[model samples]
Target chain A: MQFWIVQSLNSLALGGLLFLLATGFSLIFGLMRIANLTHGALFMLGAYVGVTTLKFVPNLWLAALIAGLLVALFGGLLERSILRRLAGNALGQVLVTLGVSFIVADFCLIVWGGDPIPIAAPTSLQRPIVVGNIAFPAYRLVVLGIAIITAIALHLLMERTRLGAMIRAGVDDMQMARAVGVPVSRLFTTVFCLGAALAGAGGVIAGPIMSAYPGLDADMLPLALIVVILGGVGSLLGAFVGSFVIAIIYTFGSALLPDLAYVILFLPMIVVIAFRPRGLFGRRST
Target chain B: MSAAARIVLVLVLVAFPLIGGDFYINLASQIFIAALFATSLNLLVGYGGLVSLGHAAWIGLAAYTSAWLYLHLGLRHWITAPLALVNTTLIAGLFGWIALRATGLGFLMITLALSQVLWGTAYRWAAVTNGDNGLSGLTRPAPFGISLDGPAAFYYFSLTVTIVAVWMMARLVNSPFGAALRGSRDESRRMSALGHNVWLVRWLTFVYSGFWGAVAGLLFVYYHKYIHPTALSLTSSAEVLLGVIAGGAGTIAGPIVGAAIVLILKNYVSAYLDRWNMLLGAVFVVIVIFMPDGIVPGIRRWSARLRKT
Candidate 1:
């Protein structure tokens, strides 16, 4: 029972981080219909920046905010200078984004020297929280809390706000939205930046646990892709659910069948694809 | 170019290995193998309208199968090669049966998921795949009477296979089945409404793609004398996609041209600059911005405009 509880908590922590990374990817895909492969690279940049900023700011929250904003700006620049040029061409977009990912990964390697950079947990959240005989990392619980808040905040924004409405409208029908003066192009850029910011935020929160490293992007990106697919493309709620499920599979599967953990991580996805190709919450095309 | 011109071009390509230096010969061979891989990708993306981000799984599967057969079963080259191709086709057919049910972005994601599954399997199945250590020490042997140990001999063997494969693809693409696949690509619902099974066509095309990928894998295993999990990774898939896009999807010869450019650039740029990735990124950005229709299409458009003048 104690082992199960710990595993469950670990899954929540992993799921929270995955949700953060995948939220941005889902947003970009929903709005632009373009697979921003460099989204992973942006997440890496966020972790690095958050760690670097913490050295000066001395406040974890402030560092995360600054990192998120900076990553958002970088995303905006990428949209304006590169992605804008490859609009409507999926293959071109994939190639360009992949190229961008390679550049970011290699640049990180050069700057960080292939070593994992340790990030200190916030002083206030460093202790372990006791729940009966089982103790869970306080920082991980904080991460879970933050993730829940973020999801709720995003849901409210998407469902209630005017900007969110415009974004949704654009996602549904770009041509119709453009005809009604929705500024589809500008909206795409904004959404891309917003998604990047979320990824950055996730990276910042996950930094202490995972550590910022050169090859971390490769691992995170695939996990994010899996989460996005399992959750369904364009569904934020789906991302959250998918993340938890995948995390749970990872934690328990590894424990139960160590040799088959990797295959087990993919089994749920395969089953999901087999049964629900659009994902758990994907909107059906009429 | 006329038919005669094309034949002459092919002849020149074949003889260039003899005249060129060792480095150039090796480079050409690498390009040919890559071209074969890209061409296989082209069958799905260009003709079937299926953008598979995980097509590298086929190549990786073929490599591992061939290597395993050589190691455990002590299979001859001729036997193993055919077995590899057949195995790849069967696996691809199974995967495609599930994947072809989805369309557009959904299909792409499914393929990516499937590729990851294969990569994970390769990593964890240590006893069979040797985990990250990879399968090594498989050498090119005298297959049925021909010595393939020398680079020159191997290059000719690869070239012959590539030519035959390309020719087969050309014939396949012009056949009635190919026409039906293209029709489905243009409008799957309409084809299905007309009583044709779009799913079957897509699955068959996917199988063909896998067959070609397996052929490329055979050449790769022979050339490198090793196989690893990286062969099935997302990176390899992405590289093949890059080659397909850079050349021009839908064009018969686009992948070959694209493969040459990509491999040559990587070789030359990496030799001089440590930040070759930045250069590669810049190149991709420029290509997408200026040549959205790809190099072949751009060239065709320019030549057409000149002819009009």
Candidate 2:
């Protein structure tokens, strides 16, 4: 029972991180209709940036904030300079983004020298919190807490704010939104930057637990993609739900059948897609 | 080029290997094998209008299967190679049946996911795949009184396979079934509404693509004499896609041209620059932006205009 509790908590922590990474992916896909294969590279950049900042600043929080902001700026530039030109061309967009991703990944390797860099967890949350016979890492709990808070904050922002309303409208019908003078081109840039910021934030937070490495970008990209697909593309709530479900399945699966964990993770996706091609929470195309 | 001109070009290609020393012959052989890989990809992307990002999985699958058969079963190349091809085709058929249900971006994502599944399986299944160390020491067969152990002999064997494969593919593309497949690519919904099974066509195309990929995989194993997990990786799939884009997706010779450019560029760049990926990335971006129809199509268009004038 204790092992199960710890495993379950670990799963939630991991799920929270996945949700953060995937939400941005979902949002970008929804609004821009551009599959940013470079999104994972941006996430890796964030961790790299955050870890580097910590060397001088010695403040984890400030480093993470700076990293997220920098990534957002970089994303905005990418949108204006490259992605904007490839609009409405799916194959072109995929190739371009994938190219950018490869460049970024290789650049990271060149700079970082393929070593895993450790990020320092906050001193207050360094130790495990023990309750009777059960023990859990406090930092993980904090990460989960922050994830929930961010989710709520995002929900409120999207549900209550005018910007959120515009985004929702744009997602529903880009043509209609453009007709109503929604400034879609600028909106796309903003959404892309915002999604980058979210992925960056996830990267910074996950750095402490997962460690920052040259090959980490490749490892995370597939998981983020799987989450986006399993949760239904372009749905934040679905991302959250799908992240937790996938995390649980992955964690438990690795424990139960180590060799088959990947196969098991993919099995659900295949089954879901076969039955509901759009996804679990995906909206049907009209 | 005209038909006669094209035949002369092929003859030159074949003859160049005989005259151009070992280095060039090896390079040319690599190009031919990679061309086969890219052509297989075009079968789906160009003809079927399906973009599969994980097509390399089938290639890797065939390579590993053949490697395993040769290592464990002690089977010679002639018998083991056909068995490997059949295994790969069956697996491809099964996976294709499920994958054909999705269209557009959905199909691309599913293929990517499936490839990851295969990669993970290969990486973790240490006993069978030998984990990251990979399987080595695979030798060519001495069947029918012909030894294929030498590099020169292997090159000729691979070249023969490429010629035969391309010819078969050309015939298939010109056939009624090929016409139907192209029709579905243009108007899938209409074809389905007209009582044609769009899913079946797509599935068949996927399987065909996989089979060709497997054949290329076999040739690759023969050429390199080794099989590794990277063969089934997403990067390999991306490289094949890059080849399709670089050469011209829709044209028969496009993938060949694309593979030649990509492999040669990759070889040359990686030899000097440590950051070859950045260069490759820049190349892909340039090609996608400036030459969306690919080098072959652009050249063809230019030549056609010149002739018309």
TM-score of each: 0.94, 0.96
Model 1 lDDT per residue over A1-286, tens place = 9988988998899898888889889878877887788888988988889888988998877888899999999899988888887778776776678778888888777876778998889998888999788888899988888889999998998999988899888778778988999988888889999999988877788888998998677777877888877787778898899989988998798788866777787778778777887778776520
Model 2 chain A, poorest ten-residue lDDT window? A277-286
| TM-score for predicted model 2 compared with the true structure | 0.96
lDDT of 2: 0.85
Give one digit per residue, the lDDT tens place, for model 2 in B1-309. 589998998788768756888877888888889999999889899999998988988889999999999898888777888999999999898778666767777677778778878888788777778989999988766657788776577778888889899888878888888888898999988988988888888888898889999999988988888989888877788888999988999789899999999999888988887776788788889999999999999999999999999
lDDT of 2 by residue, A98-196 (tens): 888888888878877788999989888888999998989988888888888888988887899988888988888889999998888878888999999
DockQ of each: 0.47, 0.59
- The Cα RMSD in angstroms, rounded to one decimal, for candidate 1 relative to the true structure is 2.3
